[model samples]
Target: MSPTNPSLSPERVRADVAELLGCDPAEIGSDDDLVDLGLDSVRMMTLVERWRAQGATTLEFPDLAERPELGHWTALLTGSAA
Candidate 1:
């Protein structure tokens, strides 16, 4: 699954995060803090591992935890993270 694929878009990422957190995708944004949403260290680790298995290399648990937002996560998944 390449980032260029529609399945890896920010909207998809947002949806995935929403699903994991049990919230609506509209509730997440590019700057939302994931820790504030009830995602603990364990769950964050699971999410990172899942992303890695799905072919994402730029995103780690720390990065996602630090900036738990759709845009940043999408960039990481797409290999556009700085």
Candidate 2:
């Protein structure tokens, strides 16, 4: 697998999210709701743990679940400490 969005880049987040959803990166709009694209609580938590391991310590499952959009997560994850 390719590297994930450890740096929290918007594009990288979108790509990673797309991969997690088993879709093409182009299919994920910046504001598209991830849950609508099939993201469940387990998957959301998995993503949170992966990102946290990659240094996105501030990322929380609830935050991502509340706003499952690339742009929103990008903004949130970008502020996280390594």
Candidate 3:
């Protein structure tokens, strides 16, 4: 993937989130709340910035923070559910 246009797939989202959470991607269920897993604002902002830099230009902090679920994020990033 290029620096300005990332292929934000479900697996990639899971991997990125899992990497920050210190857990395996498979361990995170689609309905699981990321905040419950210790995801703070700092980490969330990190994702927003990362995804934005990777071409998620319209992604905002509240977009993810409003619903911190794997499936929700997957759809938001990739425009489809896994």
Judged by TM-score, which candidate is best? 3
- Winner on TM-score (1 vs 2): 2
Instruction: Give the per-residue lDDT of model 1 (tens digit) for 1-82.
Output: 2323223556656676787889987877667776788767887788777666665655556776766666667776754431
Expressed as tens digits, the lDDT of each residue in 7-82 for candidate 2 is 6666666667878899988887767788888988888888888788877776677778877877677777764321
| TM-score of each predicted structure versus truth | 0.69, 0.79, 0.90
Tens-digit lDDT string for candidate 3 (1-82) = 2122347877888999999999998999999999999899999999989898778888888888999998988888887774
Candidate 2 backbone collisions, by pair:
none
Clashes of 3: 0
Candidate 1 least-lDDT 10 residues: 1-10
Sort order, TM-score high to low: 3, 2, 1
| RMSD (Å) per prediction | 4.2, 6.0, 3.9
Off by over 4 Å in 2: 1-6, 79-82
Candidate 1, residue 61: the lDDT equals 65
**How big is the positional error of residue 15 in model 2, measured in Å on the Cα after superposition?**
1.9
Error of 2 at 68 (Å): 1.2
